[model samples]
Target: MTSSTQAVELQSFLSQITDRDKGLTAACAAIAEIGAAAAEMAELIALGRLYGSIGAATDHKNTDGDVQKQLDLIADEKFIAALRRAPVAVVVSEELNEPLVLNEGAPIVVAIDPLDGSSNIDANVSIGTIFSILPVLPGAGEPTAHFLQPGRVQLAAGFAVYGPQTSLVLAIAGKTQIFTFDRRVGAFIRTSADVQIKEDATEYAINASNYRHWDPSVKIFIDDCVKGADGPFGRNYNMRWIASLVAEAYRILLRGGLFLYPGDHREGYADGRLRLCYEANPMALVAENAGGAATDGHRRILDILPASIHVRSPLIFGSVWLVDLVSRFYADPHFSPERAPLFAQRGLMRG
Candidate 1:
């Protein structure tokens, strides 16, 4: 753990890691470039409408078929440009339909969501950039082949949240650290060197509007949570839905909670909306490093291999205990104590 008085800069921290592990030299460089881009993005986000309708819709649609926003395009350009200066061989971005090769023989490949939570852009809510870095395979046949490996092999993963304060949450070398952007010094200052998610929490976040579309297991979990102190879990629970993954994740890391975006019956959302490579995988790495857990209801998010660059996956992450409970619901449909008549009036597990 780092003391507040130490005041480590982001670049200094990355440099120290590179010095210790020469193998991570390229990955550390890439992360530094990403932080630089994020700092610039924070400035633009602060400008908001003064930047001339940054939230306005663009005619272009992303690879996922979601309409692109003006800020999305700009963010993509900024990050791609920054990555081009680093030792990056290829970039798989949410905005681009195909993987872009920046350097044929570079040491690393990056998968990124340049602008996450664009839906909240116009509303002036929190949004962020998510990225995962992987080593370029020695004999990889194609550029896309570099990204097919499971999330566990990632060299580094992190996200930059542009909210009340620009914050960077990173997972590298089996550790999770946080940095706050200090505009005065034009750099990120390390705030927390070691972050651990609490094992339990009283809060949960999910889109209640999708309740009708969820599977029985997910419905049962939420139902019990809604019952509060009388529920099978036997504790009062608070609900939250920010419609922004990064914001939700930041909150969970700070305090503790559960955030579920499970696959539902909706046509385009059967596999869940978040992309596997850029969004879910990176977030899963960060969560796990912070002592939390992440899964796709039945399986670990880090274990799932991406069939394609743009494939989607269900995401349920946060407090380890809460995540485990949700997994139990999915693993055994009949395991719902709330559905049993014996526990109708009171919870099976008491506080």
Candidate 2:
């Protein structure tokens, strides 16, 4: 198991999963190209201030209403250029208002967040790329409608995180795999296979600064966690907030923890902050493939269909125990916060 022969390179791995289908093969090729491009971006990011103040916000905002960074545009261009060279029909990005038509009649459609957590670039924190690939359904109406399909139908989904080490995490069909860039070989080397989550959650991640804007249920949940060993949960919990989805996801996949971005009563946050397609869907598929679970509080995330390409939704995902507990809170609007101790019996305190 220690030999390099046992380690699969990205090309060989894609070839095995593509199954000789021309369209799928092309789609995997495009994803691999994206990985290569991201690896190059990682190198540039490691150059620090020499990368030309990439952390500076541009004068523009993306479709998600987030301020754009110089690196975001560059990453988008890299992904768009790579995808256009493949047999991709539609390209949807978090930064674009409308889908870009590539090979109009091609069989695959791609949705991407080229430089996720770009805000962390200047801070030298981890950031990465996220993407989802789906087959273009026959007899589509508006081509953009095809991208709104549920996460359950994704053909392949993955992300590449650029941190102290460059890593690519992928989920294809029912399998999840992890690869680390090996500078010696100039290729992504398989590091973990069939990755899965085990529910031993001792940590939770969320932006607690929005406590006043959160719903009662979210407030109660955090309060219970804060109570720690003296609280109803009967165990101390560490709080974490990286503000970067890629970094957060990488940590959760490595060690079990619950991550929440619940919908609050804020002006525009009723539906939560993350996009359904490129952000939540791809991550949901990856979580599900890893033996974890994902939900929008009340329902499994993979089962929810997107109303639009850029629709937002609350995302709560991680080990099954925590995800199911959050869903229970959503299921019972009458549940009182005073009953937090009782809820713990069904959650963290459970055997």
Candidate 3:
């Protein structure tokens, strides 16, 4: 779709991918509405004229103890209000201490991060929302364990990024797709289909500030990247750290790169920085669907079961080979640091 004219509505596109499951169809409709509302909220945020204050820091913190910006609360309220009209049964939010029970007997449960990258709000950097949809469990009282299911059981996962151009990325039933918001028509339109991450990429994203606090595996990996051509990798690598997961993920999907927020020795950050339910789980699905890999630096991210609603995780994901290398560091203690053959210089045969 062109920037001005409408091509395909998000609902229409979702309908094409989803089949006869009425519950899933209804959930998709709800997600589309949430996306639209979120995009509108983003506009208001960009203009600095929304409920409460746009970028002002609130006295409150979310359930995970992160300080809440004014926009974070507004986005949370707007999303919850929008979902109220949908057929969803249960809702879990990063801002809330507990799950909210909506339409009883409904078939869907949603875990959401209404406003990701709130730290970037004042800087006018890109931020976005993430959601994971799962089937409601039977005979549940509070469904605490239900939300703890491994990411592999997720029915659908996606995120809406508010950057230079607002876009939504989704992975449903193993297929990944991307939709750009056409503000002219006030709808999301298909921009890219079956998006894939390039398997070979040298770029990586991580916070170098935390290098001292990182584990040995994480520390050595970044050391190799910093050394570049003179070090084990034998290839110069680009380093990026936007501190915004959605924006980082978007860039990786387009080109290719590795992103890491592995658990370190720092107190309160031992489990890593990102939340498992809303951040890592959905992201792992999208990365895997795009032919990439995601891990906690020790194991597959989607395989880890959450211990709590706001449990944190060490997320490392991106191009397959880069991710594999990171995982190998944790898998084999004796694995030597060496340059990859792909990046090694070719030379004449030696006697």
Best by lDDT: 1
* CA lDDT for candidate 2: 0.85
The residue-level lDDT of candidate 3 at 332 comes to 65
TM-score leader: 1
**lDDT tens per residue, model 3, 249-273:** 9999988889999888888999888
lDDT ranking from best candidate downward? 1, 2, 3
TM-score for each candidate, following the candidate numbering: 0.95, 0.93, 0.92
Tens digits of per-residue lDDT for model 2, 116-229: 988788888999999999988788988788897889999889899999999999988686788899888989988988888768788889999999999878887788789977
Clashes of 2: 0
Q: Candidate 3 has which clashing residue pairs, if any? A: none
lDDT of 1: 0.91
TM-score of candidate 2 to 2 decimals: 0.93
Query: How many clashes (backbone N, Cα, C below 3 Å) per candidate?
Result: 0, 0, 0
